[model samples]
Target: MRHTKLGRTDIDVSQICLGTMTWGSQNTQDEAFAQMDYALDHGVNFFDTAELYPTTPLSAETYTLTESIIGNWIATGGKRDKIVLATKIAGSGRPYIREGQPITAKAVHQAVDASLARLKTDYIDLFQIHWPNRGHYHFRQAWNYDPTKQDRSTAVSDMAEKLEALGECVKAGKIRAIGLSNETTWGTQKFLSLAEERGLPRVATVQNEYNLLYRTHDLDMAELSYHEDVGLLAYSPLAGGILSGKYLDGRKPAGSRGTINGDIGGRLAPQQQAPTQAYVDLAHAHGIDPSALAIAFCLTRPFMAAAIIGATTMEQLKVNIGAADIVLSDEILKEIARIHRDYPMPI
Candidate 1:
């Protein structure tokens, strides 16, 4: 597996960061262990999970189950040092988490400590905020993303408080680096500015959804990544299995993400089918798995630090991990560009 320095930091991570959102829900403990062991054996050293995981059926009851499952693996086999652990503290979506509170100093400190306890580790390699407390355009919110309602002064103040708390965690040796998820270009810049001014831990990465169907991070985010040194940890590189052509023609396989989450949090829009088909056809024409095509494309991006991938079964895991070495030719990339122009933002 290919590896790179995470953002401007000295820490090195694999190009394919194993995503663990389906564990403890779609999969069992033994399955998660198998996936982790296989990933580590294959030199995939980075893994990404979140407090709000097993997300197809995200509920208060399933909260922390995924992290607890990883904790079980670490507690049993003692494979902690074999991987770089990255997880997030959820923000403002579930009532059970801090009563659906915003990110603040008290909230951040409390969240990190709880995560450490659950992961059975003394310190996390990278800790991230699942989303900004104020709001963002991710998760198909761009159509009605009205930032005018958000108070800028209040948001900046909250960021400052959270940075202070993160700084304390760094000093206490509880977390090595900090990151953001589901955040916008503006939010990332603001957090970095505050960290620089306040002597807090620098934001090293931003995990967001990036795939063949969704290219939101290609421009503004790419610019921020190049200039500010905060590269993207691209999630959903297969577009929640849409690029695999499995969900096309209304064929929802049993136990798939589309079957469970129903369009993947509004990602399956009314106009998404044609573009999905085009990409799948392109993958077939080149004699490769559609899923691998999508993931390999993510690895080719200039600002992609890592492509986060998940699987409910071992076969899916191998298919994603295999993309690390499959470099798409310029002919394929040019064809992809033509498809993108013909149908942009199909989701």
Candidate 2:
């Protein structure tokens, strides 16, 4: 497992960060523990979870269950020091959490404290904002992402307030670093500027959807990552298993993500099929597993810090962890480029 420095921070994380959103819902506590154990044994030191997890069918009942599962695992042993734990505080929009209120200074402090207690840890290595209060193009909102109505001045003020609260958390030793998720270039830059001006915690990373079907981050966000040193935590590197070709031909396997969350949040567009099949065929032609091919391709991105991978089964987990070692050859990369050009932005 290759490792890299997390942004400008001294902490080093594995190339494959274990994603744990399926726990406490699709999986049991024992299953999550086994996955964590296997990941750590296989050199995956970084784990990413969220407050609003088990999200195949997110509900008020399962809220925070994933965090508690991790906390339970931590309590069972002393492996916390060996792992670089990262989790997110969900932004406004869910009524169960603070009545779906937008993130504020008070909210920042409150969320971090609650997460700390839930994780049963002294501090979190990376704490991220799940999404912007004034949303942008993420979670399939790109087609109609009109940001003209967002109040720029108010947004900046909110960022400053959140930064101030995060600074306090840093001082109190609650969180070591801060990051963003489902955020835009403008929002990331604003947070970075505010942190620099106010001597607050710097933005270390940005978690966003990055897959063959959705390459939105490969454009301007790539440039921001290069110049700003904020690393990209690429999630859905398999495009919700679409790149794996399991959902092709309109086949939804029992208990699969597609079967649970129909169409994967509108990713299964009519145009996505041909490209998905093309990538899968390309992988098979090269004697490579399609899922590994997709994940290895993500690891090749210059700005990628880690490709967040999640699996419902142990076999899937093993294959995903093995992807960290599967170096994509130039031939495979060229084929990928051709396929991507033929079906760019199919999702």
Candidate 3:
């Protein structure tokens, strides 16, 4: 329920952002509605979704179903102005979206219009690029990541074009703020510099995966956010439910994220299970719920604007929302740092 300013903007969002990727895939519309209603009641005023949502299998058929569910909620008497809605435009390399075309000015215009239509909202509070067109390391691609092949000129030009399109959307009142997702420090800085030079929309936030098992944002991204006024909207604070310890001891626990997407997008490496077990044991030893511990850690980070959380059930939603009140002690934080050092980047 704690609120913080989103970047340099005057808008204040909850410390915990309700993530809606499971709306149409793992959860029904009623379940999604229940989660949203509960979150709003608990003072969560921020929600994050993407065009390519309900991503258990990420099929073309269910591509925009999540947005449609939100649209239905708005159509059925849900107050649109009560929450700060954030959505993403998927980047290149997805066959279902624009035939895997790289994001261009025309693509941005089309994507923003489509998202607005689907969300049944005149303007989005925050609009983000789901990923970079010329990608860097993200989604477990770090091991094989190579940045030497990137064309700097083309990347800058693409950012400029995208910003121009975003400016148009702002003028048209389609979106209020702009953000980036799955982006690196260099990319974020470039976008900010471009926006400043051109007087376009300023990049307000960066959504990246940050959890007990994955702390990629702790390095350069953290420093960039601290100095640049761009905040971190951390997704997967539970490491796709790995830090919750439900999948440990060879138990799938039916309907879990692991059961749906077997590997959890390469997060279940052989070396990761033992580390996850240790964290689970630590949580139990301290009489704390693992999910609460993981989420609390995210909230305590210096540069974190909000921790984006998703749950398939009302019970899970309740547990995650309760994390907003769990404060991690200095001793516990030291212990966590030790564990992180012992097993860094297991996935």
Q: In candidate 1, how many Å is residue 39 off?
A: 0.6
**Separate clash counts for every candidate:** 0, 0, 0
TM-score of each: 0.98, 0.99, 0.98
For each of the candidates, the C-alpha root-mean-square deviation to the true structure, in angstroms, is: 0.9, 0.7, 0.9
Arrange candidates by lDDT, descending: 2, 3, 1
**Residue-level lDDT tens digits of model 1 in 1-347:** 88998877888999999999999889999999999999999989999998888786888888899999999999998999888999998898689988987877888888898899889999999999999989999888999999998997798898888888888998999999999999999999999999888777899999999998899999899999999999899999988888888888888899999888987888776677898888889999999899999999999998999999999989999999999989899999999999999988887
User: Which ranges of candidate 3 are over 4 A from the true structure?
Assistant: none
Candidate 3 per-residue lDDT, tens place, 79-159, comes to: 898999999999887899999999999999999999999999999999999999888798899998988889867988998
lDDT of 2: 0.93
Per-residue lDDT of model 2, residues 27-120, tens digit only: 9999999999999999999999999998978999999999999999999978999999999888999999989999998888888999999999
Clashing pairs in 2: none
Q: What overall lDDT goes with each candidate model?
A: 0.91, 0.93, 0.91
